[model samples]
Target chain A: MARSPFNADEAREAWRRYVSTGAVARRLLRRSTYHAWARCHDLGASPHLLKAEALSVSDTERLLAEQREFIAAATPFMAALSRAASSDRHAAMLGDGRGVVLDVVGDEASVRGPEAVPGPGCLLAEETAGANGIGSPLAEQGYVEFVGPEHFIGGFHPFTCQGVPIHDPQGRTVGVISTSVRRPAASQRLRDILVCAANGIEAELLRLRLERDVERVLASGSGSSLAKLRDDVVQTYAAARVRLEAAARRGPAASEYTLALVREAQRTIERFRHRAALWRDLASDELGMRQPFRLDQRVVEIVDLLATDAATRRVALVASMLEEARVVADARAASREIFGAIVSALENAGEGGSVEIAIRLARRERRAVVSVSASPAPGVAPAGPLAAQLAYEAAP
Target chain B: MTRERSGPGPSSGRDAERTALQRRVLLVDDDDDFRASVAEVLRDEGWEVTTAHDGEEALALARALDEFVLLVDYRMPGLNGGEVFEQMRGRSPSRLPAVLMTASKHVADLAAHHGFRHHVGKPFSLDDLLGTLELALRGGEPGE
Candidate 1:
């Protein structure tokens, strides 16, 4: 075969420079050695990760196995976390603050990865380091780039990587898990995706720590005051569990390989306990919060509000609107509610959906800002601006 | 030039029949709906087609069948597309030239190692899928 015009090193370097301009990519270099090494490869900087780092091949292999084991344990929780991010393009990712990736899994390549890999496994160097989901989430943690010019590495450009750090029960960063390409998204959910995934890992740890007994106590307390108190605790626990599980499982498909999405959702919802306590404190100390409005007391009211048919429809409507405006159109609306929703969605996607929405004002659109984020949902087809651009004159 | 197989390989005076196997396919994807749709579309393009729901099933069917090439999806529930390719790679030289279906377009370098004719992505139209299929079918032979 004829050698290409540019040497491999130079080619990777140029692309690295280009990708570094992206919001998440530039910040990646700021992480610790382990994270930096992971980030380097996530950006397709394999040459540097392999050569510059003093870590031996054996270390890389060990690290890869560590990541694999971590992800395997967190799989169910991560899968649930990505479901939300996958559904709404406007959704943000849940992050544990390390790195965010979308649509690809990031991990050290195995020696055998150079040959051929089998079923749903992505090559991380030479050997298969990721089962589809982990690679994308790892990439989501640093930079969510799917096969395109925006991604620095041509080899992985076709695949999207969405990742985020997973946290242990006490919220310490443990490892990362992500989804890889089989799923694809158009833009801007990369960082957001990692955040969501990170949150998912945390939620999983918490669920494993606390959720199992929650259901039992609530059920046993079927009737009476003690039973009612137990029921209340269970309800709060269940809600928190739901959110935690969702955040973990609903991540990008690339990230959810061996896990189920519902598990993650339940995990996220389980955090209601902490939030509920915070609400109680706010009622007493904060001025805006109503007096005598104990969060535990308002649980019924809050549940009522959430359970209303209209509320459910509104959630869907909001999610769909986010998809149309932010996920598909790349337009950022300015309303506080819209902003909050978009931010939350981005956070959700970062948990593991392979979508990146990078927002800045559009090139020529007057007074309009484009969200600079990408959503990396595997198999989620990207929408085009062909029609939206044509409709711009009519976009009041 | 690569040597032709004695019997199962290309035959003498069978050069005219290149169009025959060239127009047939063995497609593998876990999604039955997707497989059916692909088969129908390929049939429309003057090709014969078969489908498999999982990687194991696809590999099992491939060994039993003759003449047709293959199209496999990288992400299935079990025995994914890559595993199927590895199995196919173990087969006799007379049978080869499988194309892969993956969303991992970034792994272009790795996918190239499978010795297949093409690696296409999912969510593609029948036209795009068939185009690559036709291209692979035209070059229905393996490389060293």
Candidate 2:
């Protein structure tokens, strides 16, 4: 490894200037480091602090347990990184998003005395530990390094540190991986290693999550799978229906091929619809296993079933207004009324219109009110007969 | 496409402007066809809809845009809908108005647990989706 590019004397002078006068010396300090310094200063962190804060025993245990998967995914990479830097006298540290060091590996004495090595459970967040390897990268959610005097706290001044944030597949910075070495030992090689290790850990985390999701879906049994398939078939039918209806409204497409295609599409759609109806009957058997279910949940089922039906008519079906009351009614009857209301609304809903349904327990009347209303589509006339007819109400 | 005005009115113009502003929304779903189809319908309904295919894109958009109702799918490849909402809530000072869309049977409980005011089951109707968005925008919690 090569000596660090940063000048120790220069960094020391820059830190001195900023700490006393709050003025950053541009050419001497990195932009990220300057921002981190400003943040630490504003947070009232003591630059003279000698050691990082540690979490309580219980809190530390909880933090580790919560990060169990993350640790499992990252441990191998951490070990590899440690081995790669063993000759360079560097130690690797892992911290969660909050900058609590979760793990450390290799050559701890090379970076700091035993008391100052940010071992597991130490809080190295910028506000607490004052901008070192883990905290700086975690705070910026990016790559950063602190060489000697650039360290915000006096305790870390004898070390050079580099860190990179590790993100899950969702792009959330879940943790940071950092390395610390004796001053002048920092090199681009160490930064590259940190970056690669972080990427590896993230990829492993993604793989673990993918397996978990697959297991969850598989564990739910084949019924859920069939339900998913049925939903797709219904959505496809609805989309096809919408296109066919739109073409029909455009007047007879005089093209023979177009006419033939439309006919075949209609046949396919009819077959699919029939199959969907058969599936409904099959699903009813399972529904019987759990009778007297919540009406709202059953309504959700009907809405999902007929979702495409409403889309075929260019009508939006709004079921979010359904209340949370435990209305344990006959699922079949409730389904019929809700289905009838939605079907009626779809029939009368003009192009691009919406049908809003609300099922609320009429506390005073002790009857559940199933209200369905429709609003006109864009560029369409308002308050027409269909809109009026669409406002049908029923209490079942 | 050229759009025809039904009639001229200062009130109607104001209403249209207001609708466009108030109806800006972020639709996050991994399904390509479903996402595109819904976005088209919402646009036709006078909504300013922005679409993202996954949670990462959704979060980036949320960070960039100051305000918009989030219509996010419950089960995504990486971060689930609840996690996305949790991240947004953690990052911002105000509560972000959002609605959950899922095929799960436990949707109602999940939505309430995640602090979501409303939820629409998957393979949902356009009306249900729009209604849920409207409810979220209005700051009204369902089943209350």
Candidate 3:
């Protein structure tokens, strides 16, 4: 038979001294252990007998469900600890923050014996079970061990146990891992193992939390980038409409072409507004929307408007148009807002300045491209409407 | 439409003298296109327009001119519009009612902080700019 290091009389004297003068017993007992002793005393527990409150089956199931992820993460550690203590009459147990025993593994006959050993659903909080190993570590948020007479209850004098508090990544004490044996073993080595196991569980919790955060950031980043693009497009379209309206009021020489162009531009503006609204709506939807709009006709009309307006400004307009301009392909739909922005950019370059505007529309296999280039007249200060206009178009 | 002057009637001899005194405007913008177009409009409306390509030139003009309302761009290569306005306030003997124009979303905040009489955002209609200018000249009354 293995004997305890301290006898019942010594433990009783130590407890009495702690109760009388708290600081006098600090050498033999940690402050946390003394606090647990005080709590057990205040809870109306008897020091000479073992009595524990237990949670009902439904409550136990709810607690297990709430801690499902934690329990899963700590399973391998629990198994390894149980195997390490197999040679001794020891049982490994996991307890929640409230001290309810959630899991157990060991040689049943040896660990359980004739006494009703604490198992799943057993409430072992210090307030209910007195100053025992499992509940003390939970209360202290650190490692704890008690052998024989060190247990407050006389009935628990036959058993010895070691426990360590498990923490989450944020350093919050989440639960306790404990091992109980009928006879006391070398406690320091057992305490070291429990601490290492708790650390492994906390590391796993940190990794899981990091992965979840990364997933959320990636999901929100794509939507926000697209929203920014949509906002820029709407602003550019508004600027284009203002420029076109200003160009139309410039007088009678190019009235016919300007009138037709303005009407077409108005219709295109309306369509662009409608599409922008739709894009906003789709972005707000739970299921992501990836719809594209056809903009070939609008692109052609905008090009014509740019050409006519440039000619009226007397800035030398030059254009090369495609016969069947495939401005937007079925697979990749281009925005009318882009074309409007380009037209606005060209008109601003030609307005009130002797800047020559060049526009080109070319058709490739699956894409239609439009490019606008401008060259200001010499002796005109380089700081002109074109620079300001280009700056606005290029702004994110 | 012939808009009525807000302060005093142009027919009054005293009001005519005041109008002549405040007829000059200092237009400062880096962009030549905006300067030429806006100067043409202001001149057509019977105000003498003096132009400057940047802030330094505008400050030099302000020192030389007797009395003028200032129209300045907010963002410039050297000495931004707000800095120029501050420098002008320091140099000018009289309170200069001015209009600050910008293409930024912070125009209202900038205008309030700098105590500008009025502000207009870019891509603004010609009418809007004229209206804001008229209001600033009229001691900032609510425009009709």
Q: After superposition, how far is residue A7 of candidate 2 from its true place, in Å?
A: 2.6
Q: Model 3, chain A: how large is the TM-score?
A: 0.49
**How far out, in Å, is residue B62 in model 3?**
88
Clashing pairs in 2: A316-B126, A316-B127, A317-B127, A317-B128, A318-B127, A318-B128, A319-B128, A324-B143
Clash pairs (backbone) in predicted model 3: none
Q: Candidate 3, residues B25-141: lDDT per residue as tens digits?
A: 788876554565566556645566788877889998788777678889776546778888999998877778788977544678988899886887654555676667766776765
lDDT string, candidate 2, A69-130, tens digits? 89987886676567546665667899999899998887756545564467889999999888
User: Chain B TM per candidate, please?
Assistant: 0.75, 0.83, 0.81
What is residue A161's positional error in candidate 2, in angstroms?
0.7
Task: Please say which candidate is ahead in TM-score: 1 or 2.
Answer: 2
Share of reference contacts found in each model: 0.00, 0.02, 0.06
Better of 1 and 2 by DockQ: 2
> Looking at candidate 2, what is the lDDT of residue A349?
66
Docking class of 1: incorrect
Candidate 1 chain B: worst-modelled 10 consecutive residues by lDDT = B1-10
Tell me model 2's lDDT, rounded to 2 decimals: 0.66
